[model samples]
Target: MSAAEELEAGGAPTNFDAMVKDMVRLALSSEYARVPIRRADISNKVLGERGSKQFKVVFEQAQRELKRRFGMEMVELPAREKLTITQRRAAQKTEKPSTSSKSWVLSTTLPQAYRIPSILSPAKAPSSKAESTYTALYSFAIAVISLNGGSLAEQKLERYLARMNVDTQTPLGKTDKFLQRVCKEGYLVRTREVDGGEEIIEYTVGPRGKVEVGSGSVAGLVREVYGFGQEIGDSDLEDDGEGGIRPTQVEQSVKKDFEMRLRRTLGMQPLRDRRAADANGVDAGAGAGADENEGRRRSSRRPAAQSESDESD
Candidate 1:
């Protein structure tokens, strides 16, 4: 009789081919496509009772049919290693802990047959050439901002450049130009204000800068060229207003001291470019002052010509 007919007639399924197919389907449908078919469970499921001579015979026949038809023989699952509380603690102490300790525990407890994909792997280094002066400057600026937790004061940046001996010939002018280009090109966001009669400019990573840094491309390039790894832990920075972290007090102090040394040794002064000052509305008339003065002088001379023409007339 067919398996279905035998089931409907209140008898255990005796069709070896049908029984093997059912068991294979059940196994494949289970988690990891492998089911533990215990003898008691099988007896209960197939015969609706445990310990039946006829059920045992049928189960053996099904196993043989499965091996013959599908070349898949049922094998016993390996015994799991059980550890006592003391043993578990000892094992945990021996294992090197990581940030993903919880995940490590879950991975250890997972079935041996099931494999979990690795979380940490060596990142492929970005394919990049030796950057030009502008590219290098851009990369350095972005890297500094990233190292400082994504935002930096303009004074701090200038100090960093001076200390690094960047553009030793004209550090002030070069730094100004670099900042302008990066800000204009959407690689950095420059916010300027006048504080106590001094123009203050602050920089933050722009969209492009964030993308490069977040993808580890900028860090990779920095590592390759500067031999300095730019990676920073998330916990190191304080939360800033712009959804990014700010540099620590120690970092700020170091930069401040370096800036002082640069000032004393190299005479690095904070440049106040007229155009930049005007752009920030700090000194709106800075650029036009000379032009306005020249216009006034010409206007003063123009009245004399007008008087000469009147006298001639």
Candidate 2:
């Protein structure tokens, strides 16, 4: 049946299908821009003025359509900012703020096996030079802020950026404007506070930032930043069972400093694991040598005993 026929067959909502299509489109636009999609935008742009109450149904349909067609789904973002001390105390006497920001960011729904580099690598993704620069800058910024207890002083941030030759200007604009654009796009949150008469500015990951380039993603990238050198480790060698050894070093990233520090603090296990097979091989060799020596001694004693027996006879 045609859409008109379907509508005539008692589809109560007048523009439900159109709303769903619009919803998907708007969501894709927001995702491509690397910004969070808000419910208000959906109510106004996609669902029309009267359709504000149809958020749940429209959202469900849009999510299903996105997953089916694009292998992506919208994830509800957490609160964009933490509650201040005063706000927290005020909330104790009244209704608390919502855990969700009533916004969403699109994320992949594809299985891990299907997300290889050739299929979805950064090189393959469509991006302009400005977008690429913005992504790298924000990703590094977020990673730094997260690693540094989820906050970094503005001065320190600038220093770090300066070290990377980002002090004066960037693809976006001057360094300050570049940082402002990142904050404006919701990739990072910048706040000012006064402590002991010192006005300090700090940067933290924002809702869109956390959802898109989360800590896990940052860590994955960092691990590949400076991979292990050509130096072989115990893990490289494997006995072929027939006596030959095989070298297996699947290329992988290794931040030796972080790894060693973490390992030493936690379990103290060396990065290169000692092979039990090699130790067992040494033990077996010693046992075989001992057996040969025993056999020689036994043969010598037997000759003497045989000679003595013959003499007695």
Candidate 3:
């Protein structure tokens, strides 16, 4: 344990300045994948793939990495057992659905396992360098948005570059390029916002983006990444973690989440270069939005068709 961390843990200054420095460390770490240590019926004697002590060591190491990289204070591992029926019922009763927000019965089914076959398989390191690029960009982008509240615009990119101590005008076209790729991937769809009568592209996450948890299992991945993908930083609102999640962790998690969602929504395709189409035909302007709307309409109309199809079958 570093002396600084020990001091902070031992009730030293718990201010944002001290915390922000730690957050930057996490943002800069190259090997900091936020996978959780699952504590189920594997055995009390073993923690990770090793014995209890070794497992504890590995857990602690991962925790330390999480702290050092993302300013996350060590949290107690999750309880192993499933919730009792009564406990679940009570919890369900207390949970009120968000009535003010719009609702849609979007299909929750996953894509066919064959398309992005690797994500569903047993853990294996990605074979190619390109496979990990989205993850890194996701991490960095999260750090930018979470720690620094800004839209994913060119100005935001410049601000992020400055924070990283890189030249503001550096030719880092990859980030923008990735954004374009995401739009093409169907994980994101862009809208034309009229500003002074000039249409500017604004991007939003899609359903596939909702499932983007990288190689990490879906369990707890949203909490680890976006602090709960639905909301940005509400985990800190509760004191469940003795004091709940720190603001820094919440920020990092949300930002990471947005990136993952962006990747998932966009898919593994190379970003499209459609800036030229900004001046082109209405066909170019219609884009995936029309296709998506048609898809949703078709999907909604399919249950009857499916029943008939089943009857025919």
Estimate every model's Cα lDDT from 0 to 1: 0.42, 0.59, 0.34
- Considering lDDT, which of the candidate structures 2 and 3 is the better prediction for this target? 2
lDDT of 2: 0.59
Which pairs of residues collide in candidate 3? Answer: 26-69, 142-255, 181-271, 185-266, 187-265, 187-266, 225-253, 226-253
Give a tens-digit lDDT track for model 1, residues 105-141: 0001112122112321111222122123444566577
Instruction: Flag the better candidate by TM-score, 2 or 3.
Output: 2
Error of 3 at 78 (Å): 30
| Candidate 1 displacement at residue 34 in angstroms | 56
TM-score of model number 3:
0.26
TM for every model, in the order presented, reads: 0.28, 0.66, 0.26
The stretch of ten residues in a row with the least summed lDDT in candidate 3 is: 304-313
Candidate ranking (lDDT, best to worst) = 2, 1, 3
Model 1, position 296, has a per-residue lDDT of 16
- What is candidate 3's lDDT per residue for 69-96, written digit by digit as tens? 4333332211212123444566567666
Off by over 4 Å in 1: 1-131, 169-173, 194-200, 212-215, 221-313
Error of 3 at 109 (Å): 10
